[model samples]
Target: MQQVYPQEPRPFVKWAGGKRQLLHELERNYPKKFDTYFEPFLGGGAVMFNLLAKHPDMKCHVSDLNSDLILTYVAIRDKVTEVIESLENHSKKYQKNTNFYYYHVRESEPTSQIEKVSKLIFLNKTCFNGLYRVNSKGKFNVPLGRYTNPNIVNKENLLTASRILQSSNLEFFCRDFETVLHDIKKGDFVYFDPPYQPVSNTANFTSYTSRNFTDDDLERLVNLAEKLDSIGCKVLLSNSKSKKVENSFSSSKWKIKEIQVNRAINSDSKKRTGHSEILVKNY
Candidate 1:
């Protein structure tokens, strides 16, 4: 097999609130040397992918609570061919019965975790805006989007990601973010990108997947950052630069800096403008 290189170019999935733009800033602030990397709240994996592309030799440990999201990473790592085939089939089927899209989403149940993983990716590819949202009962509710050509699968990128994953002394798990603290030691770097505080009352979009990161969750994360800071491990976290958030970490030893990022989720495009976000770091 040909060795996969980090130079492989891949288009990112246009995810809501993705941080592809701020990756350079992250890289600039990241420590030049570290024993390992840990990303607990991996959303669309913009930071992780960028890190993998930049630091090909770095060992990584990544986790997320969403089973579907974690499975997509696993699928790319282990079952790329199967995932691509299923996505192509989904594209053909979706072209025919648009109504059946929601029908299958609500009714169909896969026998195994991988099958469910395939279904999740199928829906994510075809779903409106690539937004992952669920109803009160935790059912996917986003409608199909209008796109002439959707890269439902990217084989080369998937293969490259798998190769990077395989080469590292890596560990992937589906668990709560707080549990990750127990595994970190000195010289490790932890990057956190938890769901930001809602921009406004009507513009609330934090419900990415089923679990909501409440204020209490934010408090717990603050404690974790403090713990990591005390242990000599570098920690960098990002969140909305709201007054409440500032107060939440006001007493912490971490240094805070603000950066503006484009906000893409809103009914009116005019309202979807740049907003301030805080990058708390102890390096």
Candidate 2:
């Protein structure tokens, strides 16, 4: 297949805890080839896009509990021209009182699918540290980001992702992680990029979506991973190097590996680099 854009596909949205930094190490650990690729915690789809850009014909399935995020993916796949137009309008309106525009869009509850996705991508790029946090009522609360020029409409990258998403079997789901149970088969590769178990109390930022992915969710995830392992599916998971994370995957069969990653999106700029995260696998 011919590449539609000059640059290869990547995550268009600047998602927190997105795996852009860890791709090289992940590539080293990836299967030489696999039947299907499954990513349950598809944040910005850093890993998914990286793999998809290289392996366009690979059957890839992704999901997130964040419905709005999934909607943006769907919009990009089916209504990209409409989304691009809406985003361009957002770019035009943002020039005047950018701060006011940021909050105004944050508080919006758009009924149209294109409008909702445009607002989501716009806020993701322009919000503080590219953070996507919401309160109990699911209202976005992150402040305006410190950027002189946020790419409100990255037409090339958006179009590239949209084209890549137009693959024959590019599936998206807005369901809980364990729902992928029955579809997975032997020789498939499943990469789990769930919200990391906070290494420190001050570093916890699980509100990527409206709900917090607590330790309980991690437990459920571990059970699912084990199920996938028992059924002969190869599984890999990423998480903070915490005692809980260590204990959860301490079984004799699982292989735990640690790698360093920069904490590029922390609130406190001083502590925003150099941290260890664990990659647990059942290959």
Candidate 3:
């Protein structure tokens, strides 16, 4: 029998707070039609890819605060062939001696775009819990994850993502969430998947980049969401179902819905239990 493949493009990397699990809930709340789609906190790009596949004709723009993460997306979109070749090289050496080679690759930082993206993907797959976290000095610092086989070179998926990005209507940016403020217009559908607010004193995990998403940042996002709502734009946001997140949105215009999301890929199996997340939206 011939093998079957999915035409839907999914996230290539595993981000800490990716929304692949909650996409169904999100889609249910998504605006029926909008002029454009904007995702400010494009981490693993799970939601972005899903939206692109569902709305190929929708004009979309996605961006992230992490330079390296954005570089990986750009490299995949522009130079996928070169990136795949580099990943193949890394995968071959990694398979030889996983422990020894993992540390070697983690320590070296490549300057070229393709190499840098490949390195990021390699470290992500091999890193502890597939987390894309960085240190205070802005370095990839996650330890190696224990995996018999970590699909480092997912060539077909990468090719599919590249083709999706090749769409003339889709655009990507490497900047802070505030960058989209000036360009967003009325009738646009904006989805904010900012880092989750820590649910408890000991559950903080918002370190995707050097600059953490502080409570003040969440406040800023709330203000922006309100502004977007005032301007006739539709806004949907997801964050931890904590007091901080709940207290941030006070407008009657926005409705909040709590939903449980899978733990997905956490190092601590104990902490991998399903948790609550809120979907706040302005329709």
Candidate 4:
């Protein structure tokens, strides 16, 4: 018998707060009707991919604050063959000397778009917890993971995502989240998956870019959501269950639903369990 594969494209990279596990709940909460779909904090793009798969004709605008990540998405969408070739080379060399090769790529910065994206993907696959973290100097600095075998290439998923990105009416941007306020229309649907408000002092891991997502940034996000709401746009936001987050979306206009999720990036396996996140929706 021939093998079967999923029709939908999955997220290419492992993001810090990826929502692959929360798709069902997110789908349930999607607004029954909307125009364009906008996702500003496009981390792993699990939600975007899911939405596009279900409604391929939807006009989608996805972006992120991380330029390197945006470049990765562009490269995969335009030059997937080149990306797969480069990943194959990295995989072969990594299998030979995992420790040295991993550090060499992590330490050496490549300038070309293809090399930059390929290096980012390779490091993300081999790094500790598949985390995309940066140092104060804006450098990729995550350590190596102890995996016996890492799926560096992931050719099928890349091809599927590339097809989705190319065939769909999608636009990419590398800008601040608030910029969406200028482009979004009244009936559009916007999903905000900003770096979750840290649940605890030590649980803070918002280093996807050099600048951390501070309390002020969270306040800005809430303000932006409110603005979107005032414009009559359908908005859905996913955030950690914290007092700050709870207080921000406490208005009667927003419906807050807490959903349990598994934190795959946590260093401590024990702490990954029993984590609850809130989905605040205005429809």
List the global CA lDDT of all models.
0.75, 0.88, 0.86, 0.91
Backbone clashes, each candidate? 0, 0, 0, 0
Better of 3 and 4 by lDDT: 4
Give all TM-scores, in the order shown.
Answer: 0.90, 0.96, 0.96, 0.97
In model 1, residue pairs whose N, Cα or C atoms come closer than 3 Å (at least 3 residues apart or on different chains), thus clashing, are: none
Candidate 1 per-residue lDDT, tens place, 81-127, comes to 77767766776777777657645864678776666766777676667
The residue-by-residue lDDT of candidate 2 on 57-85, one tens digit each, is: 78988999999999999999899999999
Runs in model 2 deviating more than 4 A are: 1-6
Order of quality (lDDT): 4, 2, 3, 1
> Using lDDT as the measure, which candidate wins?
4
lDDT of 4 by residue, 45-74 (tens): 999999887777779999999999999999
Q: What is the lDDT of residue 97 in candidate 2?
A: 82
Candidate topping TM-score: 4
RMSD (CA, Å), each prediction: 2.6, 1.6, 3.2, 2.9
